[model samples]
Target: MPKPLYQCRVLVTATSYGVHDPALKTTLESQVGEVVYNQSGRPFTAEELAALIPGFDACIAGLDRFDRQVIARADHLRVIARYGTGVDNIDLDAAREKGIIITNTPAANADSVAELTVGLILALARNIVVADRETRAGLWPRLQGISVNGKTVGLIGFGAIGRRVAQKLSGLGCQILAFDPYTDPASGEGLAHFTSREEVIASADFLSLHCPLTGQTRGMVDAAFLKSMKRGAFLINTARGELIDEAALIAALNEGHLRGAALDVFTRQPPGADHPLLAMPQVIVTPHMGAHSDHAANAMGWGALNNCLAVLRGEEPENRVV
Candidate 1:
């Protein structure tokens, strides 16, 4: 027989797991014997996880490292339910070998992330951040900005979040170009023009990245890639940070090859104040908060909570990755 719910111990490492909805924690606590929260207020390291995994029946994970060594130490772990969509931090091969089910709440934060992507694009085109700061400092200069009404916007990936971004921008009267090898070209028929990667890069006035981080895509935005972009075109990235080579981006900005960049993610989380990117006036940065909206946070919490409970109850979980 399966173990009683009251005897199961669950570890929650995602800092935002229940912050938007407290009932999620109440529900999990009612069903489990013990619920341990990560008090660190950040993702735990592999060393910390390896030390903590032995007694947990499951974990609602975040951006924490889950390597082979950490998986091997999860003696009582039956599931690793990711609180958000990405599972790039986990070692899937190790989890599969250890018979630990892996799951994620896919598309839970797509709308929120898409909205943020559009917002960043606008912010960059208009010099909004600089304008706001200047006004606050008692300067009254009229800042020049471009309108998206007649611009060509290019999207690198056409997944759920990317599609939502295109849909949101549809009414703006801008020409939308998208490049995604994995998606059906017919899907973007009315909303966007499916095109070659080379064409999108060469023609767009605003280029936005919505792609996933993979070996092939990592550092795809090197110096050559930036140099090839339309001069003075804006770049927006709401996706992974490692996708762009930071040094190349810095050089591109220094040489005025590109107009500006707005980033929601970085090569390192909470980049140091002295970081060159942080010092650039043409660069805008956010604290990786694209998925922090109440709507998205609540959805992700419930999705992860349900996935964790389902696996523990001997039922098949949704969005199972391994």
Candidate 2:
């Protein structure tokens, strides 16, 4: 009798909801001998992940903390398939050392995130949430909101999402100013580039963050940075939460220095129920749903899954991050 075709074990460390997707589960069972899944969205501890990873041939991961120790312990692990675009949550150097291929779905959620950025900008500028609350409470207090048209909008990053945002705002008749070290000065048709962050902040009526969270960018927007902005200018962050200094932002809003601010990401996930930012009427916060659109999620899952299958079949996936 021929031995059972191929004995393969797979592990999926994705957030709870995606694990229930019929397509994802069916694909895993069809290819592997055994499959384990983590339903919790929280990052798994190193020891917990290490113990479970030893025999898995592949892993479909989320924003979980997969450090060097976890990678080292996965002797049988071959590939890591990320469910989202950002790979900052994982340690790339460690995966490379283990000869494990790391892959992510880039541009899969560009439209969703770009749309969220635009929505957040409008929500904050117009005090949409606050106005609705007051109206519901029978108070007809008329609060004047700023308009996007004719506003000088500054974009800090000029990647796929950033470029899309620039296009959207430009169509709305806003002057676009962008700053990205990687962007070619002559590339964009109508976008202008500034030499310094201070210059952009000082001149713009609205500032939107689109950069990745890196060593140089973490907490880059602090008190001194906010102070340089034009008075009453609005701030929007759809990028990583750690990119801005939360304390400084609260102070700015409280002091009436900034007209308003919008955040789709936070320094801490689910930032405790009573988080200071939640109490402020001048700030708008969303539960990190920028890439949660069904279209984007489906693309991310299928793309990452296909990449894993390619690696298993000895073909290099086009989206390999490592």
Candidate 3:
């Protein structure tokens, strides 16, 4: 007789209880036995995650810390499905050593995040928030905003999202410049690439960051880097927060070296209410909502769930991180 389908126990960490509209639990229940759900929003501590992962055959994870210790404790963990593209939160070496498949949902939220990046660039260049506030207060503040047309836009990365951002900006008549060591000449976007970050910063009228945060990129945009930018140039970061030195950015804005800046991510999530960046009129900050749009969230959920199911069935799912 044929063997019955493998009955698995699953754990979901760092997700909203009702965030998944159709609910991953409902979907997984059809294929697995007994699913445990947790809604710890932010990344969990190593100890906390370790304590919660025991006995789960599979896990759908968010930005929770999945270190070697945590993976070691999850004796039954067969697969880990990440809800987003970034797998920096997961310990890839540990998962690989344990023969646990690690996967993420890449491109599920590319359009949403790319759209947000453009919106941020516009907002920073135009002082949209400040103008709206003044107008709402019954004052006709004639604040002059910079024009994007005829400006030079420098993109720091040329990945899926970065390429899309460049395409969108190109339609706005902005000259596009990029600085990516991994840029493929065959991609054929016709955008010019600079050999050095300094060259990009000095030449572009607006700088947009689209690179991942790694050992080389962390704190790469510091005071010296900011000072090298064209006076009155603008900065936009929708990628990783740690990529920019917050203190250096603040100082540059205060010194009038930069016209303005926009950030959708932060080194610290939900930075203190009194964060200095919040107090600056020229700095626009969003609560890391780059990929949080409803459409993006739903797409991410479905993609992650599908990937998990594929791995469970011993298929090579797309976006496998390990």
Candidate 2 weakest lDDT stretch, 10 residues: 1-10
Q: How accurate is candidate 2 locally (lDDT)?
A: 0.82
Q: What are the TM-scores, per candidate, against the unseen true structure?
A: 0.97, 0.90, 0.91
The residue-by-residue lDDT of candidate 3 on 1-322, one tens digit each, is 2112257777777465237576655777778767777755666777998998887777888778898999999887778998878887788888999999999888877888889999988887788999998899999998888889989988888787888887777778888788788877456256555547678889888899988878899999999999999999999999988999999999999999998898888888778898999998888888887888778888888888888787777788887888
lDDT values of the candidates? 0.93, 0.82, 0.82
lDDT of 2 at 152: 89
C-alpha lDDT of residue 192 in model 3:
51
TM-score of candidate 3 versus the correct structure, residues matched by position: 0.91
Off by more than 4 A, model 2: 1-6, 16-21, 41-48, 191-196
lDDT of 1 by residue, 27-128 (tens): 999999999999998899999999999989999998899999999999889999999988888999999999999999989999999999999988887889
The worst-scoring run of ten residues by lDDT in candidate 3 lies at 1-10
Clash count for each candidate, listed in order shown? 0, 0, 0
Tell me how candidate 3 scores on lDDT: 0.82
Model 1 gets an lDDT of: 0.93
- TM-score for candidate 2, residues paired by index: 0.90
